[model samples]
Target chain A: MLSVHSVLPSLKANATSNNMTNKINHPELCQWLKSIAIDRDKQAFTQVFRFFAPKIQRIAQSKINSEALAAEVVQDTMSNVWRKAHLFDDSKGAATTWVYTIMRNVTFDLLRKMKANKEDNLSDDIWPLAELANTEEEVFTDHIQSRNLQGIIATLPENQQQVVKGFYFMEMSQEQLAVHLDLPLGTIKSRLRLALGKLKLKLGDPHD
Target chain B: MIKHHPKFELLQGFVDGDLPASLAAGIAIHNNMCASCQQKVSQLTEQVAEASFEQSFHHKIIVNDEENLTEIAEMDFDDMINQITASDDVEPTKAIYDERSIDFKGMQYTLPSALRNIELSKTAQIGKLSRARLNLGEGEIHTSLLHIGPGGSIPEHTHKGFELTLLLAGTFADAHGQYVAGDFIMLDKRDQHQPATEHGCLCYTVANDALHFTQGINKLLNPIGAFIY
Candidate 1:
C-alpha cells in the first residue's frame, strides 16, 4: 500500500520535482524509517508514507484488476511497510525491491483468489495500471545479498545443493523431490534436514 | 534446544509458501508454539524476498491511455535524477511515517483455491499422490490418492472425522494389519493406525476430516490445519 504522504511531504504546496529530490536525500530517510517502525514515531512515518506512496500506487495500479482494488492493495502494502520496516535489511535489498515485493505478494494472493472464483466481472480497463518494464532503470542489483546465499549453497555438496534448489527455487514438494531423485522418501527428507542444518551453521546466526 | 522436526521439509514448504492450504493450516497451528521453527520461517522468508529482489523485475506497464501514460513515461526519465537529489539532500532519518491502515483481507481468500487442483503424477514407478477435489457447495471435499512403491506406506495417524481407504493396487497394512487390492478400510475419529505398503500399495483415501496427530514431530504441523479441511 502506497501513501501519498510517503511520496510527498508537501504535496501541491512545495511539490516541485526538485523538492521531491531533496526529500529523497533527506539524511534521515533510513533513520526516520527506523524511528517510525522501531520508535513508532508518527510524524516520521507520515513523511516516509508520503514519499513512498506514489511508487506503491504505481505498483498496485500495474497488478490488480481494478484501480479501487489496486488502491486497497497499495494501502495494505504500505501498512505492512510501516509494520515491517524494522524487518527490512538494507544489506539485502533496496527500499524499492522491499516495497515492490510486498506489492507482488499481495497482488499474487489476490489474483489467486479471483482466478479461483473463475469470475470475469472486472474488466482490465478498470485496473489502476500495469507495471512497465522499460519505463525505469531500476536494476535488480539493489538486492544482491542473495548472491551470498547462492555462494553459500554452492559450498554444499552437489546433492545437498540440488535438494535445496529443487525445493526452494524449483518449488518441489518433498514427495515430488523423492520421486524425481529416485531416493527413498526418508532419504529425501534427511538430505533436506542436513542441508538446512548446514545452512544455519554457515549463515550468520539468524537471530542476530 | 531446538528439536529436529521429522517434517522439516514440510516446514520448508511452509516458509517458502508452497504448502497446500490444508497442510499449511496444520503447520500454522504448530508454529504458534514453536519458536525455533518460527524463527526459521522468518529467516527463510527474508531469503526469499532477497532472492526475488536479485532477479531483475521489469514492471510491465498495462495501462492503455496514451496521454496519461506518456506523462508517467516522461516522469520515468527524470525519476533517477529525482531519486539522486532526494538521496543527497534528505537526512533520511527524519522521514515521517503514514498512519492509515491498509486492509489485505482479500489475499486470504486465494489460499484455498490455489491448493484445490494440483495433479499428483511422477515418472517414477512409485506413482504420485493426487487430490481430486469436489466442490460440494456447503464446503469442499476431495479424495487424496497415494501410490506406494512396493513396500511403501503412509505413516499411521488419527482422523478428526471419518476416513475411508480404498485399495487400488498392491497391498497395505494398518494398525489392524493387512489389506489386499480391492480391500476397503473405513476409519472413524476413534481409529488410530500406521499404514505401510508391504509390496508397495496404491490406494484412494477420502478423508472427511483433518488428521489429528497424536504423537511425534508431526504435531508441529498442526497449526496449518485450516488448509486441510
Candidate 2:
C-alpha cells in the first residue's frame, strides 16, 4: 500500500521542491507505514522518509532557527519513525497526523533540552504514545497487540494493563514507589494484595 | 462528565505545536479524561497534518508573523536512508496501559498519564493548602499541582494574568459553581472567585502571572501571590 512514487528512488533525487506538496494521499502513505511496520521493509521506509523529511526540516528550522538542530530533529524523528513504525495504527489516525505528532514532540524535546538544560524529556509523558492501547484510540506507540512483552514483565491478560504501565512511564520500582509514595513497604504490599483480591472478585474467577 | 474544556484556540495551538509544554500537557491530561475533547483533538490533528504536508503551509512560517519561509534542504537522501536502514533492530514494544500515581502528604493520588514523567518540586505547605510545581521551565508561566485539604479554601482573589485549573481528582466549588473531575476552569484578570473543597481536591494549575488578592484582611497577603500561583 505504501508506494511513494512509481517514478522510483533514483528519479526522486532530481525531483525538486514539489516533494513537500507531493500528493501521496492518505491510504497510500499508510500503506508504506504498514509495510515498514510488518515487514521491516527498508524501501518502504525510504519512501516514507522522502515524503516527510523536507516538511519536517522546514517545520523544525522554522521553530528552532538552527540548521544543525533542525537536521537533528528530522533525523531523530525519522529514525523513530523507522524504529517505532509498528506502533502506528492506520485505524486510529492518518499517516500525516502520526508524523506530525512525532515531529512536534521532537521539537518540544529539543526546545526544552536547549532552553531549560534539563535531562528528562517531557514528550513521552505528555503525548504518552502507549496509554492509548487499553482503549479504542490505541495508536502512536500502541503495543499490547504489537509485540511479545516478555522482555519487560510477563503478565496475565487481566493484569496486562498493570504491567504495561511499567514499560512507557518512568521506571519506578516498588521500593522507589514506596519512597515517593511515603508509605511503609508492608502497607504498600498489603494494599496491593487487598486491591488485587478485590479485583479478582470483581472480575469473576481468577482465569474466567 | 467534563463541563469546561480548554478553548478551541488552545486545542488548535496544541495540535499546531504552538502551545507552551505546560499548557499542552494540561490539555493532554484533560483529553485523556474527557472523551469529547479527545475526538476534537484527533480531528484537529488531521486538519493540521493535511495542511502541513499537502498545502502551502510550507510557504509560510506559522510561528511568528515573520516572512521567513525556510527553504527546504535538498540534501543527500541516499546516504541518510542507507545510514538509518542499517539498523534492523525492531524494538520489542513493551507497552499497554498507564496508571501512574503520585504521593502527596502521605496520600496516594493517581496522576494523569501526562504527568508521569514530569518533574515536580518538593511539596510546599501553606495553611491547609499544598503545592508542587511542575518544572516545565516556562519561566514567568508557572504550573503546579495544588491540593486543597478537606474544608480548606483559597483566599478570595482575582487573577493578574491568567489561571487555568484542571480538576484531576476530587471536587471543588467556586462562586461560579461546583467542579467535578475532568473540569477545565480557565480564568483571566477580569474574573474574581474563591474556591474551596469540602471533600478536598487535587488540581493541575497554570498561571502566567501572580494573583491579586481581593477582600479585606487578605490584601496584605497579596505578596504571597507568587507562591499560591
Give the candidate number with the greatest lDDT.
Answer: 2
The CAPRI-style docking tier of model 2 reads: incorrect
Model 1: chain A TM-score against the true structure = 0.44
Cα lDDT of all candidates, in order?
A: 0.47, 0.70
lDDT at A87 for candidate 2? Answer: 86
> Could you give candidate 1's per-residue lDDT for residues A1-208 as a string of tens digits?
1122331122224233332222233245566666855666666766666656555555445445366666666566666666566665554434544555566555645554554443321211111112101123332242333234566777788777767765674344577567556688898789888888887666533321
Compose the digit string of candidate 2's lDDT tens values, residues B124-151: 8887789999887888889999998889
* Tens digits of lDDT, candidate 2, A97-121: 7888888888888888887776677
RMSD of each: 18.5, 17.9
Mind sharing the TM-score for model 2? 0.74
Error of 1 at B55 (Å): 7.0
Tell me each candidate's TM-score: 0.34, 0.74
lDDT of 2 at A91: 72
How far residue B18's Cα lies from its native spot in candidate 1, in Å, is 4.1
Q: Pick the candidate with the highest TM-score.
A: 2
